[model samples]
Target: MSVNARRLAAATLATGVIAGLVGLACIHLLHWIQALAWDMHGGTLLEAASAVSPTRRILVLTLGGVIGALSWFLLFRRNKAITSVSAAVSGTPMPPLRATWHALTQVLIVGLGASVGREVAPREMAAAFSAAAADRLGLSAEDRRIIVACGAGAGLAAVYSIPLSGAVYTLEILLVSRSGRAVAPAFLTSGIAVLISTGFTRPAPFYTVPTLTPSLSLTVFGALVGPLLGAAGWAFKQAVARVGAARPRDWRLLLTLPAAFLVVGLIASRLPSVLGNGQASAQTQFDATWAAGAGLAFAALVLAAKTLTTFLTIRAGGWGGVLTPAVALGAGLGAVIGLPWAAAWPGSEVAAFAFIGAAAFLGASMNAPFTGLILVIEFTAQGPTILVPAVLAVGGATAATTWLTRHAR
Candidate 1:
């Protein structure tokens, strides 16, 4: 190999290595921060709420959101933002300082009640730091791309402890139309990050489900729910678009924050399970009394409210990811449909439907079926009995959303 080729290889190796370490570090820092924040907030908020109302802890959720958003606005909103992971795929560089604040805002969003996951925050920060490093070192566009991809994969792998999914996400989503040359560096970083993340947390998959088979009646019934989910996805897209457009109207938009919080708080007081990520509730739905007496209309309303409030929060400049909140909503809706099936068919695959609901909702909302599917599988690691249903719903959801936008500019 030529001297220049050798130097480039060495540089790529070094960048990937540093990016990998930073990625590992970033996830741990975020987790440490989250553990303290969630615990303190959860406990204090629960205590405070219990003092007056014997009802469950719903105020804690809204209070956390208020605190997070207020801090972001008062402290961090003035900075010039950096290119996020999604933007860096085109080889653009972003400043780490900016990504850092965005990361903080994202954590705040989730810590409060914005209805999303926290992974997007630090992942973007790591990508920005890696991209900034590449720019400072005067790397080529190809190198910059690989560096950014490595950084993103590292963040995800570290956060989730799933290197294969992280690597696949970088390849399938980040490098959607790119060359295979980007693979080696990204894979290396992701592997390193996964090791670090798994070391910190249990390596077990996110959830465990009991073995359940879908009877013929339940299978057919779930298949029928596919169209309704598609419709919900379309409605969610419209709500997001509407809220995005509302941002330019005025600062009056921020009013929706407290208003939406009030409503969500009311809902959570009555239906506390809808407050946070739904993985726990989804797992326990077999015995949750809240799942009972809830009809399709109730599920539809909660789904709509959660989707709208989430969009409103972001539109009002609250930062967060859309994955978990959407999943929680989807799970609620799916349980509404699945509970009835379970009532009739004792061996029904209710959890499977809940899982599929999550994957399909995420696929439609994000327009990334592979990310949705892989995340669903890796997050749960349940058997193919569940995976098969999720894949089917994801494919259908993706096709429907893509078809609807076939003529869009």
Candidate 2:
């Protein structure tokens, strides 16, 4: 390697290592906070909610929102323009302290049972730290952006244990680049972060899928369901955007934050599955048995409740991501659609159908079908037999979403 090449490699390696360590520390801290606040062991917020009473669930969520609002007021009162990791990777200057506070507040709110995903915190913090490191190392602007993007991907890979998807997410979503230079650092950073995280956290797939056999009938069913999910995903994105566009104010925060928590609590009182980021609930839908009528009804309720509650949480000044909630919503919708079919088809896996919904929903929402497909595959530890249907679903959903948005415009 040439002298400049060697220096780049060294900088990349250092960035990866730093990102990995930061990811590990943040994850551990999240777990500790969860244990202290909820008095539960290890699990996602929904799983932890299962162990607590309905009243406690309500209290925790309300308290969390209040805390989150106050934290936002104190930390980000002056600078309310939160820069995303993607924006940072595109040459926007990142404020390290502000980003760190943002991530920390997210972790705290999610841990306290806010209806949002915890993944954003680690990614934001990782990007901020990596950007700072790159600046100190005197790297070129382009190299710094790539490292920051890689670091964001590393944080995601560490948290979810999906290295390949993380790398793809960095290249496709964060950097919007497919060059070799982009691929190398992203893959290296994600791999390193996952490696380090495995030492501290157990290595396990996020979701378990039952064995499924490929069939023509399944493919057709997936194709049909994809567009429906696409419409849903598009609706969800619109809801979030509509809610997010409103300016944040103290009165709005005080009223909406608690109200959002109240709604979550009310929903949790009957359907605890709608709580948290929805992962535990999605897992339960995959594993548990329900009567066709009752199951479908419950699934629909959760689909609506989760969607509204997540929207409320974000609109109320709570910090978190929607990907997990989207996955959960997709799983529920898929289960509702697939249960009847599974009854007719003796060997069909409802969970597998739910998995396809997940990929499709995420793909349509993000406009990155490959990332969604790979993420679901990695998260579920499914085999290649599901890929054809997953791809079909994602493609259908993306097309439907794009067409709808275009026409609406």
lDDT of 1 by residue, 1-409 (tens): 8643554555455544554565555545544543543443333222223343423234555565566556555543455244657788676656676677667766654544445556777578768777766676667776667677767767777666767667777877787644656677667677766655455445666655555455565455546675566556656666666765554223342455555555656665654444443443344442234444555555555556555556656676555565666665556566677767667766665666666676677667666677766776777775366554555566677777777767453
lDDT of each: 0.60, 0.78
Give candidate 1 regions above 4 Å deviation: 1-66, 74-82, 200-202, 212-224, 248-263, 277-305, 341-347, 407-409
- Tell me the tens digit of each residue's lDDT in model 2 across 107-189: 88777777888888889988988888887777787888889999898888887778898899998888889888778999998
* Cα RMSD, each candidate: 4.4, 2.2
TM per model? 0.79, 0.93
Pairs that clash in candidate 1: 64-112, 65-112
> What lDDT is reached at residue 77 by model 2?
55
Candidate 2 lDDT (Cα, 0 to 1): 0.78
